[model samples]
Target: MRVLVAEDEQDLADLVATGLRRHAMAVDVVYDGTAASERLAVHDYDVLVLDRDLPGVHGDQICQDLVGVGARTRILMLTAAASVPERVAGLGLGADDYLPKPFDYSELVARVQALGRRSQAPVPPTLRRHGIVMDTQRLQVTRDGRFLRLSLKEYAVLEVLMRADGAVVSAERLLESAWDEHTDPFTTVVRVIISRLRAKLGDPPCVHTVPGAGYVL
Candidate 1:
């Protein structure tokens, strides 16, 4: 899943982004609403972790603008206000979900995961294909019941490929979904990761490279 975190609190924003990345989700962090708007306009994010009160553009207006444009990005409005009225107001402003401040890290991850699923076609928490099994909830992967140790990038790329269900996933798409905004578009890191992933999966390789296209499993 690709996520855009728009929080004015720099520390919190970085913390959340780091946590999400550890779970193999490509995440972009922005401290202001303007940056958030720019990222939203340019990327097809599956979820937006937006702080309700933001400077420069205001998160409420950002949500309104996204709704106006009919964007599919799922919004999880966040703030310190834990009142029922506040949550209802945030939802009324077009946020798909709401979470208050000082929340549990696990719950935050769960909420993001839930919103991500709602943003696209429903998919099981555990994805299985070929001889590979991915338990997303546990961040575990196995092939033929043999555990596979993979880095965050490798795991993210593998998850993207497996989610394709054998359909070829373009390199551009893979990069978009597996890496953050800091990644260089022309970098060969995707190829490098795929090569490593193929090796880790062992014999009877499941990841196949399409000469003129991309990769499939």
Candidate 2:
């Protein structure tokens, strides 16, 4: 899943972004509404964690604008206001979900994950292909019943390919879904990760490069 976190509180924003990344979600953070708008315009994010009182261009407007344009990005608005009316207002502005501040971290993660799922075509939590089995809920992967140890990035890339169900997936698509904005477009990061993944998945080499096209599993 790819996520954008728009929060004016630097510490809170960084914390949320880092935690989401640990869950194998590609995340980008902006400290203000203006920067958030800029990033939103450029990236096709699956979810947006927006603070309702964002500086520069209130989060309400951002949510409304995105909904107005029919963007598929799911919005989860956050605020310190715990009142019922406040949440109603946020949702009325087009937020898909709303969470009050001082919320439990686990709940926030669950909400984001749930929203991410809504943003994309439905897929089973457990993916099976080419003798490889991925239990997304447990963050576990096994090939022919042999459990595989993979880094977060490796797991994310593998998920994207497995979800493709034998269709070719380009390097650019992998980067977009598995990496944040900070990654260089020309970097060999995807290839390096793919190499590591192939080694871990072992023999029979199901992952294949299609030369000028992309990769397939």
Candidate 3:
């Protein structure tokens, strides 16, 4: 999933971004609300982990703007204020969920994952195709019951393809879904990752290229 974390606390933002990346999410971090707004305008994020007390542009205004446009991105508002009224107010501003500061990292991850599922088409926690089984909840993958150890990027790319359900997925689409904004648009990383995935998946290849079209599984 792709996420935007808007937090004024630079340290906390970095930590959250790193943690989310470990979960195979493409995350972009912004320490101020202005940058957050810019990224939000440019990227098609699945979830927005927004801080209420952001600088440059208050998070409340950001939430209001997104709501005004009926954006599809799910928002999880964060704040140091833990009162019931505070949460209610945050949710009232159109956030899909509210999470207080200093919250459990696991809970944050779970909430993000839940919101991501809501943002996209309904997909089961587990996906299976062509003898390949992917358990997203456990972050596990296996081919014909044989466990496959893959890098996070490899797993993320594969997840996009598996979710396609045998339909063609263009390389640009794959890059957009699996990579953050920092990735070079001209990079061959997608092709490299696909080659690596094929090698790891082994025999009776599942991922196939469609000449100029893209790739299919």
Candidate 4:
């Protein structure tokens, strides 16, 4: 999933971005609401982790604006306010979920994943094709019953290709969805990741390259 994290606390935002990246999500962080608005206008994110009290524009306005624009991105308000009124206010502003600050990281992840699911068009929990199986909820992938050990990037690239269901997925699209904003668009990073992913998936050579076009599985 691609996510936008709008939090003024740089350290906390960085930490959350790192944790989400470890789980193979494409994350972008902005320190203030204006930057958040800029990124939101540019990228089609699946989820937005917003801090209610933001400097430039205030997270409440961001949430309300997102709703006004009819964006499919699910909003999860993350703030230090734990009062009932605060939670109600956040939700009333169009947040899909709310989590008080000092929250458990695992719970945050679960909530983000849930919101991500809600944002996307529904697909099966486990995706299977050509003897390969991907259990998204369990983060497990197996081919003909043999488990595959894949790094986070490898797993992410494979997931994107497999989800394509044999349709061509361009390298640009892959980069946009699997990597963060820091990735160089001109780099061969997507090629390298796909090469490694294929090697790990092994034998059958399901993944294929279509020169001048894209890749298919």
Candidate 5:
């Protein structure tokens, strides 16, 4: 999944981006709300990790703007304020979830994944196709009761395809939805990842190449 991280602290932003990337998610880090808004406008993100305090634009306004513009990206607000009223205010501004400062990285990851799952179009948590079972929450994949080991990127690609089920997803769509904003659109990263996933999945003709289009699972 692709995520936009809007945080003022450079070090913290980098750390969050690195951790999300390690989980096979494409993440773009922006230091302030202006850059965050621009990034949100230009790219499709599964989730937005926004800090409440920001230069140019506060995170609340950012969330409100996104909702007003009908952007489907889920918002997870991060703030130093931990009061109940503060959390309620963030949620009222259109944030889907909220995380206070000095939070656990694992919890952040979990929340992001939960937001992603929530953003999906009303699909069950367990996505199954062609004998492959993917547990979105557990981040586990199994084929016919056998566990399948996948790298982060591979797993992400499969997840996207599985979510689409029998529908064809173009490469450009995949790049937009599954890759970080900073990733070059012209690159063959999606193709490479799909190839690796096909190899790992043992080629049951599940992921079909659509010639001039993209792939379907």
Candidate 6:
């Protein structure tokens, strides 16, 4: 999963990113709300960890803008203000969850996971197809009861395809959903990952390339 973290505190941002990365989640950290808004507009992230006070734009405004634009990324607002009214305001502005400053890192991680689970597009928590089973919570993929070793990007690609099931997912859609903003779509990165996945999946070819279209599983 990918998460975008926007915080004015350099140390806190790095700390949060590092902790999430340890759990195999890809993270992008930005120091201001303007950059946060820009990143949100271009990339697809499972969750947005936003600080309420930020440079250029307030986090609440950014969250509101994202919701107004119909962005589905779940928002977890962080602020020093711990009042009930403050939390309510954040939620009213489209944040899915709110955490005050000096909170526990474990709580933050749990909240992020909960928001991601809630934001998913009505798919079951665990997805299974073509003898392949994916456990989103465990971040594990298994085929025919055997584990499959995959790189982070490869796992991300397979997760996207599996979530879509038999639907034909376009290249642009996969790029937007699976890759960060820095990844170049023109490059054969997705193709390479798909090739590796196909080799690992073996005989039945769980992922099928549709000429002039995209891929389906």
> 128-214, model 5: which lDDT tens digit per residue?
899999987777999878898998778888988988878999999888777776678899998898888877788566777999989
Per-candidate TM vs. native? Answer: 0.97, 0.98, 0.98, 0.95, 0.93, 0.89
lDDT, model 6: 0.85
lDDT of 3 by residue, 21-69 (tens): 9999999999999999999898889999999999999999999999999
Q: Which is superior by lDDT, 4 or 5?
A: 4
Write candidate 1's Cα lDDT for 110-167 as tens digits: 9998888888777798999998999988889999999999998899899888888889
- Looking at model 3, how many pairs of residues clash? 0
User: lDDT per model, in order?
Assistant: 0.92, 0.93, 0.94, 0.91, 0.88, 0.85
Residue 213's lDDT within candidate 4 is: 88
The model with the greater lDDT, 3 or 4, is: 3
Higher-ranked by lDDT: 2 or 4: 2
Question: After aligning candidate 1 to the native by TM-score, how far in Å is the CA of 142 from where it should be?
Answer: 0.8
Q: Indicate which candidate wins on lDDT.
A: 3
Per-residue CA lDDT of model 2 for 1-217, tens digit only, reads: 8999999999999999999999999999998899989998999999999998989998988999999999999999978976999988888888999999999999999999999989988998889998999998878999999999999999999999998888899999999999999999999999999999999999889999999878999
**10 residues in a row with least lDDT, candidate 5:** 198-207
Residue 99's lDDT in candidate 2: 93
Residue 52 displacement in candidate 3 (angstroms): 0.8
Summarize candidate 4's per-residue lDDT along 1-217 as a digit string, tens digits: 8899999999999999999988889999999999999999988899999999999999999999999999999999999998999999899989999999999999999999899888876778899988999988778899999999988888888888878888899998898778889899999998898888788778889889999889999
Sorting all predicted structures by lDDT, with the top scorer first, yields 3, 2, 1, 4, 5, 6
**Candidate 5 ranges beyond 4 A from true positions:** none
The per-candidate count of clashes, in order, stands at 0, 0, 0, 0, 0, 0
Model 2 clash pairs?
Answer: none
